[model samples]
Target: MKIAIAGGTGLVGRALTALLHEQGHEVITLTRGKPKNARHVQWLNGTLPLEQLEGIEAFVNLAGVSLNDGRWTAEQKEAIYHSRMTATEEMLRIVTQLSTPPQVIVNASAVGIYPISTTATYSETSTQRAQDFLGKTVADWEQKASRAKELGIRTCLARFGVILDTEAGALPLIALPYKLFVGGTIGSGKQWLSWIHVHDVARAILHAIETPSLEGAINFAAPQAERMKSFGKTVGRVLNRPHWLPVPSFALQLALGEKSVLVLGGQHVVPDKLMATGFTFQFPTLDEALHDLYKS
Candidate 1:
């Protein structure tokens, strides 16, 4: 299979790219700038050379900036929203123009689309929308990605949670405080933390591509969701450190501004749709995930 990936240079993209290559699939990356290598092609202002998308069997769109990278100023928020919307819209445009459109289009989304709650668990069927900036952004993101379905393509919206890995995503930063022996719960500690191992993230995307019936929003999260306090303790145990100190919400809000919700806010999400299709998680529990990530 030939797979074309947009934003194939980011954290999740890199992992997905490597996984596809291991499976003997030819991969081409669509970038915002000039082709960095033989594998990359440039996409300017949502326009691309149509020939590049021809005969592509699968399209995995993970194009977006890190929501946690910096404080979300007015300018930063616009960039975050535009980056996802434009990239996805561009992919749809290219696919419609292709002589042979891909069978599956797996788009990157977030569990943050659901409203934040301490006890409420959310599934794909949930009707209420998140009332914040990130939530609205994801809502629009999914809407744009869903447009591919109108072209008779099986589209899968992967609503990923906190992806845990030793090299990148949220794990390293969350583990750093534990490694230094100052780690503890963030905020009130009861907030839920829905997470998945990076290994499963790649597998889930492949599963969506192979399974024709799998479409719409699929939660790419573990079956077991943990509270912030418990999650902190588990990380501490894995790192052989003490979970004693607490990072105040005020401090985080002051430092991260509106972006503090990425940590202080919480969501209890599950991979019901993914599991319904018999997709098994590599790290179903926090203990299993943390141990695998921190093992020396």
Candidate 2:
């Protein structure tokens, strides 16, 4: 199969590309930055030229600014929003214009699409009612991906949780502080964190492509969802570090500004759609994921 990864240089994207390549699939990387190695097709503003949109069997749309890139100011928030929505819209438009569009679009979303407040339980069937900045960001991101349905292509929006990769994402950032024996949970740490291993995540995308029955929204998260405090303790235990001092919510709010929701706020998202479709997870437990990610 020939696949195009929009943000293929990113942490997860890089891993996905290599995995796909190893599996004997043709992988094309669409980037906004400098051309790296071969197999790169630069897409200005994430828009593929009309002539270049043919023959691709699948598209893994992971093009967006990093969510954990520090605090979210007004400008940074707008960039985050536009970066996702605009790129998705461009892909949808390009795919819509194609004579033979890709069979599937595995677009990335976030667990934040579900409201942080668990007044009502959320599943794939749950209606979207996002209030916060990141929530609204994901709301629009999924909205763009849903456009592929109009083109008669399968659109799979994999709303992810905190991706559990070792060097990138939250691991390295938190590892150092923990290694010093001062790492602990942020805020009251009662907020739920529905996370997934990067390997499971990549494999799930491949599943979406191979499985003809998949469409609509699917949560790309493990079955083992835990509170932030428990997550800290689990990671601390996995690394043999003492989970000591806590980072107060006020300090996090001050440091992260509106982006403090990443640490202070999260949702209890379950991979209902993915599971119902018979997707097996390799690292469904926090300990299993952490142990593998922390592998030396």
Candidate 3:
């Protein structure tokens, strides 16, 4: 299968590209510049002008602004929205022009799409749009992916929570305090966090591609969900450090500004849909995932 990955320069995109390539699939990277080879194409203005994706079998849209980059100003918020929406909108237009449109379109969404008010586990069927910035952003993101279904393309939205890797995503940020031996919980440490190993995340994506039954939003998270405070204990145990201190929500808000919600307030999301579909997770427990990541 030939897969074209937008935002192929980022962490998740790079990992997915490697996974697909290892399976002997031809992977094409669509970036900001012009195309230089068959495996790489440039998409300026967040869209391709020609029907370059003529015979592509799958399209993965991972192009979006960093969710934890910094405080969201007026401009940053717009960039975040434009990046995801514009990329999906463009993919729709280009697909309609294709000689044979791609069979599947796998897009990136977030668990933040679920409103933060509820402490309940959120699956694909959960409703009620979140009112916050990140929540609203994900709602729009999924809507964009849902559009691909209109053209008879099998569209799947991989709604991710925190993805664990050595230097990518949230691992570095979460490990910082632990490295300093000041690791602790955020707020009451009761916020539900759904996370997955980098390897599992990549594999699940491939699963989505191969599974003929996959459609609509699919949560790419670990089956077991834990409180933020307990997660601190696992990290501390893995690093053989103390986990006594606690970072209050007010302190987090002060430090991270509006982005603190990502750290202090999180959903207790579950990959119920993924598990029910007969997909087994490699690292179900947080300890197993943390030890593997820290040991390596």
Q: Which candidate number maximizes lDDT?
A: 1
Off by over 4 Å in 3: 34-37, 46-52
Task: Give the count of colliding residue pairs in each prediction.
Answer: 0, 0, 0
Q: Indicate the residue-level lDDT of 33 in model 1.
A: 77
In candidate 2, position 230 carries an lDDT of 92
lDDT (Cα atoms) of all candidates against the true structure? 0.89, 0.83, 0.84
lDDT of 3: 0.84
Model 1 residue 231 CA deviation in Å: 0.5
lDDT of 2 by residue, 1-296 (tens): 98989989898898898889889999888888766766787786544565655788999999998988857878888889998987887787778777789999999998888888634456888886778787777887888789788888888988888887877887676677788889998788888888888998888999899888988888888987888899889989988999989999999788778878787777888888778888999998999888888772
Error of 3 at 22 (Å): 1.1
Q: Candidate 2, residue 135: CA error in Å?
A: 1.4
After superposing candidate 1 on the true structure, give the runs of residues whose Cα lies further than 4 Å from its correct spot. Answer: 45-47
Candidate 3 lDDT, tens digit per residue, 1-296? Answer: 98888888788888898999899998888887666677778775645545556778988888888887767778888999998988888778778877888899999998888877436878888886789888888888888789889889999999988999988788788888998999988788878888888888888888888887998989888988778888888888898889988888999888878877887778878787678878888888889999888873
Q: Report the C-alpha lDDT of model 1 over 1-296, residue by residue, as the tens digit.
A: 99999888888888889999999998999888778887888885546667766788999999998886778999999999998987888888888888888999999999999999997999999887898999999999999899888899999999999998888777788888888888988899999999999888999999999998899999999999999999999888878899999999999899889988988998999899899999988888989988887773
Give candidate 2's TM-score: 0.94
- Between prediction 1 and prediction 3, which has the larger lDDT? 1
